[model samples]
Target: MKKFFYILLVFTVLSSCSEYQKVLKSEDIATKFKMGEELYNEGKFAKANRLFAQIVPNYRGKPQAEKLMYLYSNSFYEMGDYYVAGYQFERFASSYPNSEKQEEASFLSAKSYSMLSPAYTKDQKQTVEAIEKLQTFINVFPESKYVADANTLVQELDFKLENKAYSIAKQYNLISDYEASIKSFNNFIFDFPGSSLREKALFYRLDSAYKLAMNSVERKKEARLNQAKEFYESFKKAYVNSEFISQADDMAVELNGALENYSTKS
Candidate 1:
């Protein structure tokens, strides 16, 4: 029984060594790259990236150069490595500007940046760059098949950038920098009129005006209060059921009560 066990162990070791040596041998790269495409089509992105990376540098300036770069870029995209993928895609676009894949490459490069975009509360360099690149794609390939999707992504990222600016402007109000707060909010509203943040921007606008009105609450600041009223009314007209409606209404009542008391004293 011990001798039989020894024989089984020897066979297992030999089998393992043989398989490892086989893996060490260089594969038929074209066949492997094709297999990678198959796996990529199957959503096996990791394996596809490995195969693609293996081929591109070695196949430089070959017919497969452009194709491998494109496939490699796509692999990064499929694996959700947006930043690297974005760069890879951009490289492909620039390298093969007249290639058949130009439209798709340009669009995908911008798409990669869009995917890398952080939330509304984060840095927006990627968001801004994405917009520029996407618009370039739109301009260059107005009739491309990817136009609609590219436009949609650009719109979405622009909204995020608008929201980020809007929120930062509100922060100034929260900390009582009324002048800067108003400026920030106004900039957000004016620059991105097509933003889906329309109602939200208007709401924050009213809030800024309200905060400005409170700058001198006890010193008969009727002018500021009147400005607040205008903004509040605008907010009400646009977003009647706004969550801030009650607070706005309360401000209105308080201002009216103050005016009435002043009249009584006079």
Candidate 2:
């Protein structure tokens, strides 16, 4: 009985495919639209897209154009071709500015771009684009139901950028490039004033300055040590009870002792 049922199912599928192929090659536009909508409703988006793509130009400026364009764009999204989905949805929204589907189309367009955001360690061009698109969506649709989701994606992308910058700065410290590390951390602090990594950035900046001072020539040593001492003081004031306080205190003592020894030698 099961074998009989399996054979019946296979036959039905083949029959449907045969009819679908016939529709694909037919010159009957209305039949194609109907079959495409049915295929889409059945989650057969690739086949539906093929049908829709054929008739879309023929139906342009007709009563069904807007709906056809929306479905066509969504087919790309459903297929996970996000770049094409983003472009197609953006086109639909612009082509039908007052469409009832406009808000959804715009949101999906930005969401598609967000899907293209690569890892935090990669080049951030797509991440920047995603943030800009999400921000634009929020500004245009302040009360949108998708606002919270859009905001979350923006925050995630922003943190990715922050982490990328922070990692690059920290790499300089790891490689003993004290001068570049100090400059990078300073720029990081200025750029991401509210970063959760601010304390760490400050700590590393102080460490870099100290290392740079210790390695400098006698004439430059005093000036660099003074700068390192200032960094230590600032860090202490900002993080009085921090876990790093003890380590920072040790660095301070080293800076002061070095300065005194240098002065004695002079």
Candidate 3:
């Protein structure tokens, strides 16, 4: 009985494969469309994508084009081909403005771009583009069910940009390029005032200023020390209980000791 059941299942699988191959090679668009949709519904997106691609241009401007294009665009998305999926879904949304699936297509198109965003350490062109796409989707579909998700993606991408900027500034500090580090951190603070990293930025900026002052020549040391003192005060005012408060106090002790010499000279 077990052997019989196994043979029956094997036969069924072979028959299905045979039929799929026959339909794939056949020149009949209707048959291809039927099989493609069946495969799509059964979660066989790869096979469905092949059949849909063959018939897509032929069905253009036809009554079934809208449905066919939607299926085609989604098959790419299902297969993780985000670049093509993004473009195709954008095309589908533009082509069928009144489609019941139009909103879904637009949202998915934006989502596909988001999926293509690389890590924060890499070049951030795609990250910026994804944020723009998601922002546009939110503006266009203010009441969409997907708006919240789109906003979340935008926030995530925005943070990636913020992280990249912050890292570059921190890198400058690590290399002992205190002047460049101070400039970069200043730009970062101004650009992303609401960044989650703002606290770190403020601390690091003060650290850079303090280091630069401590290393300056005798002629420039007094003025740079005064500037560093101002940075220390600003950081303390913003975050009295910061994690770096101990280190900050240590730096302040050295700064005050140096400033006292200048004060005595007056």
Q: What is the C-alpha RMSD of each candidate to the true structure, in Å?
A: 5.2, 1.7, 1.1
TM-score of each candidate? 0.75, 0.94, 0.97
Task: Report residue 260 deviation for candidate 3 (angstroms).
Answer: 1.8
Assess candidate 3 and give its lDDT: 0.96
Q: Estimate every model's Cα lDDT from 0 to 1.
A: 0.80, 0.94, 0.96
Off by over 4 Å in 1: 1-43, 215-223, 233-250, 256-266
Kindly indicate the candidate among 2 and 3 with the higher TM-score: 3
Show the lowest summed lDDT stretch of 10 residues, model 3.
226-235
Clashes of 3: 0
lDDT of 2 by residue, 51-124 (tens): 99999989989999999999999999999999999999999999999999999999999999999999989999
Tens digit of lDDT per residue, candidate 1, span 1-266? 99999999999989855643443355777766777677678887887787777767778889878878888898898888988988998899888988998778888888888887889898898889889988988998899999999899988887888889888988988888876887887898789877777777777777777767666666656776777777778778877887878877887777666557657977
Q: Taking the tens digit of each residue's C-alpha lDDT, what string does model 3 give over 97-176?
A: 99999999999999999999999999999999999999999999999999999999999999999999999999999999
Model 2: CA > 4 A from native: 262-266
